[model samples]
Target: MSLMCDARDIEVNVTWPGGPGTNQRLEKVPSRFAFAFENEDVKGMEEDCWGFGVPPGARSYGWFKLLLDKARKTEYDVEDVAGELTNGLLELPTDMTAKEVVTAYLTKIYNHCMEMLEQRYTANILITTPIDFWLTVPATWQAGAVDDTKAAAGSAGFGTRDGDTLNVITEPEASGIAILTEQAERNPELIKAGDNAMICDLGGGTQDMQILTIKAVKPQVQLEEAVPGQAGKCGSTFIDQQFYQWMEETFGEAFTNLPKTKIGHGSKFMKDWEGVKAAFTGAAPNKQYYVPLPALGQALGATGDHGVASTAYDFMDNAVVLSGEDVERFFEPVVEKAFDLVDQQVSSLRRRKQGSTKLQIICLCGGLGESIYVWKRFNDFCKDRFKGAVKLFTDKQAWSAVVRGAAIRGLNGNTVLSRKAKRAYGIGVHRPFREGIDQEEDSYHCPVGGKRAVGAVAWFIVV
Candidate 1:
């Protein structure tokens, strides 16, 4: 920070509370309080309290499912909370809004950075210094949602630095920017100018895609969007939904209906499933795996051992036996959606066939994108479409790619240019309608120009 006193190029490493992937965790440094929250547990998260020494009236908490149970008991609007997490904001209480949670998290980070940087410089330098923040959001998020995130970040004290500005970039584009910059650092020739690539960022909450065309090499890694980015709620969590359904089928309605907190044993099932999903290569006809179920005690309660309980489910040996064939079904929906999105993005560019729209590279990143199954599916798609010409890249740091990329972009490096607009743009105008030239009924006087113009669209832009 001292060297890059102009926050534009400043770099600081930090961690998010209970992130979706392992890369989000900052190890090596004492975490002040090691904590994480994931899966459905995030639905009930109300707040986070972390800092140095005994902060006034602090409540130390861990990733516990009981938050959901508590949320249901109170007037905590869960539907609104879930909406806030996925979308942008909801008309909920200040403490319960996702915006508040995110800002608070960022505030903690800001405070930590100040504490660390202030040690080397006096308050005069620290107070006068300018620091800019760049936040990354999912490509699927609407403009309003991006604005909401920017507003939240500003509230978190990040807006106080420098020009009181906060920049927002799509997660996929940011990762692409980081990769492009790194490629240049290694060897400029590795990624030649005009090279076209697609960034597939499949994270826990959303799947974001961005197609870019390299514009320059010598000056810096500049990029232009060959096609508009596309994204949706197609992430690993979708697979979890399928597994939850399997639980309902394998166990019983009682298990499915039970509150998240009461189902402590389900955690074991989730962990085991993650292992199975990770190691699974392909469909093996006879291969089978056992995912243990919660014990059902003899007392016959929801929390009891399986067979003996009336409400709890019973397994042959306290496990749900799943075959490789059955496991494939659970992932098909999510994997298929990802395939479709990629195909759609690539197809759009191919149809246009303008300005080196060739997608030579397909880079996958994020927690779900790292899956062997996901890689194979995309690789197969690319092989058939490009006839083995497209290269697939998924490095080890993919989980942290977005953050790293956003950091690089914060340094004020231009990595994208001429992004294809997500939506079509056209202007409404007035023109005289002639006989047989336009439909008689389609003619109408222009409100502003007062001229009879056909109610026809010009379709000025192809995309």
Candidate 2:
């Protein structure tokens, strides 16, 4: 097998062109490395790296296409979408919002990153030499690319409800890439850590569980995608699904019956999908949600009848109460399977133990890692089963931790240096009418250009 290696594994901080609230940044330090040569496979490894709701992976792209039904909506003018909500992450996009357009455009790149991450280590084996590979590019770059590729792509208007919202901005994703690349260059020693550790990147959209087992000569993060591990398979989207179904059942046609309710809103399932998706990643298969029905009804407005035309608050009281039992019923098997996978890995590790090498830290980064239920259950299982020998890193920064690590990694790529440490960055954009459009954009920027680097590259990824 030919080995594809770059002397410097660049780091980067990815972000949006305009800036925060509408873009994303690495919330944590990241890791990057060159793909090495295995028997017949080209392999390199990274840990704790993740591309959430809109990951840059083929599966993600495929998933987006399946959800959008793009073939049926030829009139969709993507450039017309725009937004201006603060805590933009909290704001849902209307069809007019830029979220949908940006997401569709970004999905292609997200899939590209996923492909790169998957193949960087494994693809080279199929080839014969250390060839240069292109990681995914961010949206601003895509802006030009889309204009050249899409038939409807054109000068678009921007607004929140109607007009321009975010001020001048740079692609946050690109900014993240630049920072991460620089960080990686500054601190190559951190890459050496890959030899011993594995990454657990649990996020709002998906639980990206990767295993980086260090071999003496070869050190890289291996995706345990094929093999299940102790990590839960579900994600925040799971909870959202439950909430949606429950609302649909209780409210009946009322859920979407209001005059203001647009049929297209239902298509934006990805918003609440995060709830269910996050639930699946927890140590326990079960999760609970106490959504105030009235609040939902209010959001739905005239769409819901409230059974008796009663006050919205009254309707809220009648709403269903989700429980662990309900969650377990749907997620138990998946959770158990996750544990089983982890057990297998542990067993494998035990067999490989030669003498007395100490185990490394298993860091958990991502929104799901912050799940109280998940952490409690996972903690209980680890202590009881592993006898507390295994260490799981659960910090408050857990949700945005991977981006933090990615940023530090990006910083390492640059010439600036102080001491060794870890940290993160980014903004979130929400699309109301599209599938899987709630994307996080990197917000870090190069002071010089006031824009993010062209593509989002990073030195190290924790998940």
Candidate 3:
């Protein structure tokens, strides 16, 4: 499932043999949840008043998963979480803690999936057949955050039924499986065993890059990591942030002075920006794009410079007209960060192979991965650097690659044979203290033998 602000952010795809032909069904649900109150009496509201809609005065808590991840290093408190929430485009409710908000959001998604399943195949099927859940998490997520996700899923009733199970895999791995499987089926000649291919999973909030070597093509596909994965917070959401920043700079007080309650998250201005963002391809260098300014419609009159001169943009027809160069300014930085990640992985693979091996394929998958401008930039980079030695791969299903891969993994099984550690991990051990070598602060007396010892770290795996 995707947690972006897009309309088709959360998707549910079922693969069962008991249903109709192909036995596969897919549904896209808005990644939106709201809690509406009637006369300040929130406690008396039914469950129907919440979950999956844009009702009037309802609050949408986007990116709550980030808070769950943050809870790993810091304590989980309402005040801290509330502060983080308020710092964003949305505000948190005073009565609910961050955990409660996440639980509610997940539970709502779960219930909606279950209702769809019951409608597709009668409720009897749900009761009789065992159900297994496979979830995809960002590769950059910490182990503690993954555990938090599992706990939240359990609280949402997953793995609660008899014979039910839940499994979690990194989002890049899932996308790799789906893309490799599709490539193997459609064009087997494009890739073969022992060839290294880099997978770039660019989603809404994070970008993960990994290199994998094909192990076997026959008797089911198998894969092994060529190098450890790398990830960063440079995703499509950053582009949106850049867009908002541009609005503030270009429009001045006419944009910032707007009422926060009416022009904050989920506003019409953002909705229009989404359209403009998706349509931009950097294909026409001389063409211009326009985004409607519904919130600033009246403010445009007050500014008095609506049609006035500007090097990058102009205000006309109650909209902002941006040149192609202006649009590229919003996307170039984020895309370049992603390119840096890809370069790091490629450099690692080159070092491992002693500069003898060449990267055969570069797979791009996820929401931002579908950007035509992004694809063009990568294509040009590969041509100039690799001299056409690398083949770029992407598809129309790039946004749903993670969920589709999860469904494929649930139906079949894991295709990965081995993986490399992203970083070094070790255990702390007590060693006999050496007067000259050990630090005084690290020395401690052993309880078993009453001997002086020093704390030391034993590394088992190194990146």
Which candidate has the top score in TM-score? 3
Q: Candidate 2: worst 10 consecutive residues by lDDT?
A: 77-86
Give a tens-digit lDDT track for model 1, residues 1-463. Answer: 2322122242435443333356644421211221123122343334444432212122222211112112222111111112111211112222454555556556676776677668768788878877666777766555556666777667777767665557888889987876666666665556778788888888754677888888886556788888887775556655656666666565565555544333321244555677788777777877777665544222224444445232223344555567777778877877777777788888888877578757787888877766887788788878887898887877555666787777777665555767776655567654777767777677777677664755555555422
Top lDDT prediction, candidate number: 3
**Per-residue lDDT of 125-225 in model 2, one digit per residue for the tens?**
52333222222211112233333222211122111112222121112222222322322345434433323333454433234443333332222222111
lDDT of 3: 0.69
> What is the descending TM-score order?
3, 1, 2
lDDT of every predicted structure (CA atoms):
0.60, 0.35, 0.69
Pitting candidate 2 against candidate 3, the one with the higher lDDT is 3
Winner by TM-score between candidate 2 and candidate 1: 1
TM-score of each: 0.67, 0.39, 0.79
Q: Which residue ranges in model 1 land beyond 4 Å of their true spot?
A: 1-128, 162-164, 184-190, 257-259, 262-272, 275-279, 285-293, 296-319, 423-463
CA lDDT for candidate 1: 0.60
